[model samples]
Target: MTETTPYDADRARFTRQALARLVLCDHAVDVADGAAGLVATENDPDSGPGGRVSQAFQLIELAERALASAVIYEREQGSSWAEIAQYLGIGPAQAEERFAANLEGWNTAFDVPYRLDETGRKRIPQLPTAAYDPAWACEKLDRWAYVQRIGIDAVSSGLVMAVPEEELPSVTP
Candidate 1:
């Protein structure tokens, strides 16, 4: 039996966000490097001061956004306010207040895959298509694999656990 728990969901969410944060930070570094080069310009007036300065400020803005995302990720992973506070080097109340302030306009939107019954039947209907969509069935199987990776109970996905390969309709040319 696949083991599923709330912790698994939280962990998967955290993993996804962490990857996004890494990519954002990497971009910030690239931006800073470009700005540094512009700052060293000998004759280009446009690159002398204004350009690099604005880019430098952008680094701060990106860092702040990344920090807020981290806070949200931690919370979703079942972290206590006090724990976050300790990580931020602030009191629990202050941590909560600051995080809330930062996340005021944040959106935690995400997509959920369709559920499937144990007999490899789709629990949710696929979106409108001209004909039977094999890709939709493939996507459902992918979702199940992801659930398994996250240690979440596949049963929570719906009825049966996995989609049998034979259940997927084959396309004929």
Candidate 2:
């Protein structure tokens, strides 16, 4: 039998924070890749400003893609819509609608073939599709890096921890 390791509260907290940071870093990498690609495509010095804006747009698209991936991963890990919505600072319905809209496309774009053991069925895992848009990926990387920096501040300040339900202010009459 495999030995089970007991959960350490501090370790759990650290792991969660680390994962968030990783997600942010991934987004930044995507943005950087996109920007680099756009720079390589510029033939006219006069179009530099326009190319920069294009690169920025690509980064926004990459951020959207990264958020989509996070949503999917969280859902698969059993996170509730309400919890996710709270984390995203959005209403549950809005989160569901936004995620659902892009979920299918994201899945289709990144799906990799695989097989299931339980049902002996074949399947594919969804992969991040940002790579398809190199410029967007680069821009996304930049934005993600910025977000990560902000997150680091929040984490360091103890603002990223999960509050106990009892500690939350009551809304009931």
Query: Highest lDDT, which number?
Result: 2
What is the overall TM-score of model 2 with all chains considered together? 0.41
- For residues 1-173, write the lDDT of model 1, one tens digit per residue: 23343433543543444533443444344454445444443434445457656667876776665576677667656789999899889999999888885444333222322335678654442211101233332354446446545543323333342676688889999
Structural similarity to truth (TM-score) of each candidate: 0.39, 0.41
Clashes (backbone N, CA, C under 3 Å), per candidate, total: 4, 18
Q: Which ten residues in a row have the lowest lDDT in candidate 2?
A: 1-10
Whole-model Cα lDDT per candidate? 0.51, 0.56
lDDT score, candidate 2? 0.56
lDDT of 2 by residue, 53-109 (tens): 877787789877668767866765578899999988999999999889655654454
Overall local distance difference test of candidate 1: 0.51
Which candidate's TM-score is highest? 2
